[model samples]
Target: MAAKMKGAQILVECLKREGVEVAFGIPGGANLPTFDALYNSPIKVILTAHEQGAAHMADGYARATGKVGVCLATSGPGATNLVTGIATAFMDSIPVVAITGQVRTSVIGNDAFQEADTIGITRPITKHSYLVKDVRDMARVVREAFYIASTGRPGPVLIDLPVDSTVAETEFIYPEQINIRGYRIQASPLIDRAAIHRAAEAIAQSKQPIIYAGAGVIHGTAFAELLELAHKTHIPVTTSLLGLGGFPETDSLSLGMLGMHGFEYTNYAVAQCDLLIGIGARFDDRVTGKPDEFARRAKKIHVDVDPSSINKTVVVDYPIIGDVKQVLQELNRIVQAPDTRAWLATIQKMRQEYPLLYREKEKLLPQFIIQEISELTKGNAVVATGVGQHQMWTAQFYQFNRPRSMITSGGLGTMGFGLPAAIGAQFGRPDAVVWDIDGDGSFQMTTQELATASKHKLPIKVAIMNNQHHGMVRQWQDLFYQGRHAQSEINPVDFVRLAEAYGCVGIRVEKKDDVRPAIERAMAITDRPTVMDFVVEETEDCWPMIAPGKPHDQMLGTYETLKQAGGVPQHRRSDPDEEAKLSLG
Candidate 1:
């Protein structure tokens, strides 16, 4: 029998019924009733210092566990703080349900104390949003929020609850059946036979074909199907940054990450292919460079669950609107693959010629550190990254062997995303090794999350590439503005001390030799979190950069480092323990 309960109680009970065991959030005046409801609940609530961090934690948890992440925030300032993190999840198509408290329903539009327009503010970024004025609507809204967030083309969903409505009495009837009008949320589409056949025919006939996969492949849990398709056809695969772990990076068919900071050969393959099969990937500017010039030689075949994303950017010759897994499964059965021995030879030669190598000096290079970490973990660790140079280095260097292993802020490029995300991932996959590779500038943005992790006893590892500048911004200034680096130089902060203050074990590596040992030591610890501060090269820049509006083939620094190497040791620094003052990282 349904019993009388407050709306907040019904909301919590609904979440419990939805199988939410953990939540990340902060409590405030507007959410006191919900907090009171949560007091006796079985759910584990992690209170983060900032609402943004809480949102990211939820997103990371969602990505790692293949479930919707939940975060709570009070109205006004707290809700506003969640916007960036919400946008980040939305852009990446992560499943997250963000619940924000609002002012009393009676004073919602009167500009009451601690009131802001959360529904209006979040409408643009969320897949769907709700303004719950009626207390009875709470249970249904929570169910809808999770359903919308986790299905179709997964994205963030928002719920704005008035304080008064939440505290009001309601008959608790957690909806076992939901009927949302005009909204169909399912994994697979109504399979179109003709479109699948045509896509298959195009694949069979093409001499030079490339499979470009994206995050959708991960979301669909279709990596096996993707690998089967690739293996059966013997097609070389290249991935977007978000798609890194979608295909096995160590496989012979793998061409690594493709785009602005992508492997040069991968871009070449995408541009020169006779057939470009974009599976579950929107051709973002970073991938396409200039839409008009991108894949000019290819007859494009685009497959996506979202109809709007098809031909929204780069026009497609054949568009298939369906779940990527379902489409690939059908395609594999009906189609015949090709022998790309000649194509493989061509790509191999390009790969050998245009390798990703930096002009190394005595000082420790951030890229090398990432490579070492990858080797130590054997591509088994769940790695997350903050934006900028460190983020790029992690993508370029760390070879992910499985889907959902690499998590970063791809679409929104949110700074301070790494550490908090690592915390969330650790919670989601408690047995998996989780690491946050962060830039100094980005790490400081959510450094306070370390305290949260410490309190929860989450054994997350953080590696901060301390390159004393906003690395990516400084890189652009160095190249485009003729070295006029304004305000990019960051004020120095001792991250080691900061971590210690937050009750985390801290390690600092000033020498190239100490990086491996330090990382190993951190991995050995099982009781708490640890932060590694590596004071890396200050002037090193991420290369293979496609300047804005430029074509993929027109990246500026390609092959320059290879020419400079000439056959000597790739990295040569004056002293083993010297600072990274006069070297490339």
Candidate 2:
């Protein structure tokens, strides 16, 4: 006789079989059966204050662990809340499994209380989705969800379970593996050998060559392979926002980040290079700036698991439809060693000439403040950011040495992401330092999370970059709309005082020198969460910007913009311990 199992029990068993150790969600009536199933499960269930928080937490976890981050939610609002998070994970190609409850099967189309067609709502964002109409299919669907989520070009997948279905009885037999006929994740070994040889020849013959990398490296777990390739070829590398930590920022060849807010030298090098090798990066309008003018001087070699991404925006001379790690390994084996000293030297000179700079004035800029905090944290802390100028600044400045060290609402560009995400990151890693880097306008979106943090006694540090406006939108208005900063201004709040109301510590930094000291003090005080407010430069903008639809080479170089501002820090000062002067090549 076979043992009986509830739908939820079978779901848990399936997740366990898939090796999932954590599930993030908020409990509700529609999900009660599933929550009951989780009561005694080995997989840890982290309760987030909001469903959105649960989704982002799962996203951060996936990014850090290279596993499928799982999020659970009830019907209606709970399900809807996961949209932004799902979209974020999708845009970044992070693996996620979002499980949502639906109304009873009888009431699904009738629009019963708290009912929403989560599958339909999420169809556009998720890689795939399913609504389990049968209890017997639960285990198989769960298994397939994991397979789809973790396979090639990983992304978010959804499984919608109705409340009644969760209470239904079924035999619990977890499948050991999944075999989908139409889903083929593995790249074929029989790629165009001639094209590969041509790519190798181009690299060998080029006097200047660079690799433009994207989030694909992180998704494929190919960072080590990428490093090996870059080191072997002696090619300088630049990354997209999602591609942070794809290469070590501390490495000599790493050109920080590239795109709308990229390193000036990185953009210039792409423009000046004879050969441009793109690895897993999409030629996004922000990254490419002027697509027609991007890398105009260079011959392009594009390697990606998704063939559609090749030559979609920017034309490529050579295309390889293979996995990044596999393609790089093959290229390394086939390519002859070339004399790239001149190219490497040119990059080194550019790095020295136009390094990332945030000037050290009496008052510290938000970028400088975040970099200092990141440095002090030693890449061990998990930093979350709200979407805006500060988010871009954090991506540009923070030298993340570890995976999942930095979490922001990258895809959806959602405001109010930091506080809740920090809450999630802290819950996910209790011993790890967690900082919520937020802006005044964005912080208000989820300020209620401070109450949750206080209730849980989670010691999260909230850094408010108070610029008195919606900085990014304001930046756009300033650039294109003749400085019409309509509806962007927000009344400043005494963040320190606000934290007191939430039973947390709050410190205000009015001066530049006070930024680091405030952070140190907050780090020292471990009793409760703390909020620090910094008054940053109101007019400071992220440099090396690639105006929309522009090519990679047409980027706003630091010399023409950032250096001209005279506020960026130099990176090559004699005193390695202090802020370097900002320079323009």
Candidate 3:
């Protein structure tokens, strides 16, 4: 049975069938028909301040809720605005379906107003793309877009719907199942049993085994499985930036984050481990740090759903391609605990020697603010961040105890991602407390979203680490550019006034004692959004940095105590490599 309906109506019906509760976007002339269809629908539409914000909002919703997030835009500029957000999702493997309105099918290529090659432009960034030319194809395209976006590695998908198709009538028959040729997702039962056994054997045999987890664990909903495997094996765990909440940081076996700005001991563990079990983790350059030297002594076993990711970067001894949760389940059934008492002792010693620390200055520090927020929230809030020094500080300081708790721009490092992302996260988890720990530079990038938050009366708290300059850029200039200030210095703005103008509560804290009170005030306000601008020390830099192309063991700024006490392991101490000569300051 089929019902004749306009293409736009059919598209909304398809969305309803897919169980979409909400969408984020702004309406434009080309998408008027689709907007009209949405007007009478059950789904709620969040009209964003900008298309880019809409895309990030969708991404944030997906990351927070583990659902395929949806966003809509018109052709040309509206479509172009989504590029950065789409790319961010693609890089981080967030599931998002971006629908764009194109010109009429008759005038698509004839220099029509607001027409752009949406499909061609987004092909590289999207997992898949479609241009619906006929009303009959509208339902199928929407179905395929959602299917592709939510399956496999899970990335963004784009559908460019021509305006004429929205007006055209079609016999709508939403497909109950999708069967795309040459497209197959590796299901749990189909996982290779032999590889799972082999990986288990390797884990059991290793004396110093480490579980290097990534965002894949979160995406595959395998945090419990990952926990089971680690506890069963008695192996220590270290995660990539995006992998923070995949394992509880409070666990004794946890090594926190292990990368550029990761804990000093976590990097040491990576250097010393004999077996590296990378479950749902890509050995990214950020984590690997000088590929040849990364885990030089460790035999690697990589488990991923995508086959191409295996041997795509650093080659591994055992490659198992399967869903992370399923693979971990199989491994847990047969895996035996290794004798890791001595290894754990060594890591504990390292942890004690080089704990994350910042100088106790008279001026407020970003690390203290993050720790305060973590304590005030009881480590149970959904925290999002924009890229820069503040981002790393949050990663270093915030104690994440649950999955999907830390939303950030990891692979893409997109500035201005926090405000919109926080707004989206609030929508996805309406009851959960959401906070955006953003740098001043990053906050200014998408501060306009504050209006959107106020419009919806979403109670998302924002803490701005106002360092008066592009903190990370300034740090790099100090280290590599001979201390030239360059143009990193940003002129100050009254964020308090700006927030009030957006119809939100605003607070500013400039002293050490004012930090906690300001945060408490913001936290108390649950009726609407709140912004706290803490004017921090201008020259404070994120420490324990591993310079580019340097080995993780050659990290700079291992607090003076480690040097004076000679507590750093002999092997883990920085060698006199040329790069090591770079200033620790």
Candidate 4:
């Protein structure tokens, strides 16, 4: 049945059909008609203070709920403001759809107010983009946008609607099927059985095998399959930063995280493994210190849906291009547990030798704060973080037992992502506890979103590690730049009062003893948002860092710590050849 309606009305109706229960955005002259249509619709609209915050909120919602998140904005400045957030989602492969309202079609090129090339600006960051000049094309574009955003290698999609199109009248008929030429989602069942068998054979032959999983494991919903494959094969597991919760960190085989700042023993295990099974993980530079030196002794097997990712960095012996879950399912059926007794013993020894530890001081520490949160929440809360020292600390200390429990800007390392992401996570899982463990420098970037959280009464607890400096930047300068403290030092702001101004509860803790009580009080507030300022040591650095371009085994902080603790192994003090021999055996 066809009925006459404005394009704005059709847009709202199409969103309803796509199961969009909530949208985040702001209104302007170009988007007023869409806002007017939303006024009468059943969908909940959250008015964000800025367009960037709205985009991040949508990203957070999608990551938390595994749904295609939606955000709207006007064409010019509004569309431009979403660039950083869109890039964040694209780098991390989060499914989000951003809609922007443009000027009238006739005035699009006339330099009219609030007119920008929305499609041109967003093409690089989005999976697909559309511009709707005709009112009748609204339904099809919306359908395609959602489809593209949520499909294979999920990323963001953009839809640009002109003001004239929104006001124009047309008979609406939403498409029941999508028929985009040259666009195909790889079927999960069409896996190569021969390749799976070959991978299984390789697994059987290897003495020390490591499973390096990534966000794709979570995105493909292969958590159970990954666990089964690991358990069946008795392989130790390490993950990229975004892949933290793909395998339970509390498991015996779990190696926390493996990267530049990963656990010292995880990197050592990766260095000495005979076989590397990469599941949905790209060999990012952070994870693979020097690509040529990464897993030099290991035969690599990479499994991913995107074919281009295979051998894009480190060459692989066996590349299986299929869904992670499907490939793992088939592999689990044929795989047998390898004799990794010696390998597990070696890894356990390394773990015991170089554990994650920080100096106990009278002043508060970020690591202690994160440990408290993880203990209080039983490692079940949806933990979000901004990029910095705090982000790495959360990845290291927090025990994530489930997927989608850790949300952050991994690929882009975008600052100011924590608070808005927490807001979105709270909305997606209303009954669950959400925490934003943020740094002072990163939190100040998008701290205005506290208003949105307060207005909605989202019980998202924010723990600010107020170190009064750009912690990571300071660390780098200290290590690489002769301790010249540049503009990294941040002026102190009263975060407690700031939280109060936003209509939320605020608490500040200055001593180590107050950390647990502050967290407990924040946890007690179940109505509105609560911000806690824990003034931590200003000069602490994230340890066990592998300098850029260095091999994974050549970690800096661990050797010093181990030497100080009188636990430095005889092999660690030897040359690379001796270390490899000891680690390999």
Pairs that collide in candidate 4 are: none
Please give each candidate's TM-score.
Answer: 0.96, 0.92, 0.96, 0.96
Model 1 bad stretches (over 4 Å) = 185-189, 565-585
Evaluated at residue 187, the lDDT of candidate 2 is 68
Mind giving the per-residue lDDT tens digits that candidate 2 earns over 192-288? 6677789999988887888888878877778888888787877778877777778877666677777788777777788888888889888877777
| Residue 497 C-alpha lDDT in model 4 | 100
Q: Which ten-residue region of model 1 has the weakest summed lDDT?
A: 572-581
Q: What tens-digit string does per-residue lDDT give for candidate 4 at 285-328?
A: 99998999999999999998888899998999999989888899
Ranking by lDDT: 4, 3, 1, 2
What TM-score number comes out for model 1? 0.96
Q: Which pairs clash in model 1?
A: 362-573
Local distance difference test scores for all models:
0.88, 0.80, 0.89, 0.90
Residue-level lDDT of model 1, residues 56-107, one tens digit each, is 9999998888999999999999999999999999999999999999999989
- Top candidate on lDDT is 4
Q: Higher lDDT: candidate 3 or 4?
A: 4
**Which wins on lDDT, candidate 1 or candidate 3?**
3
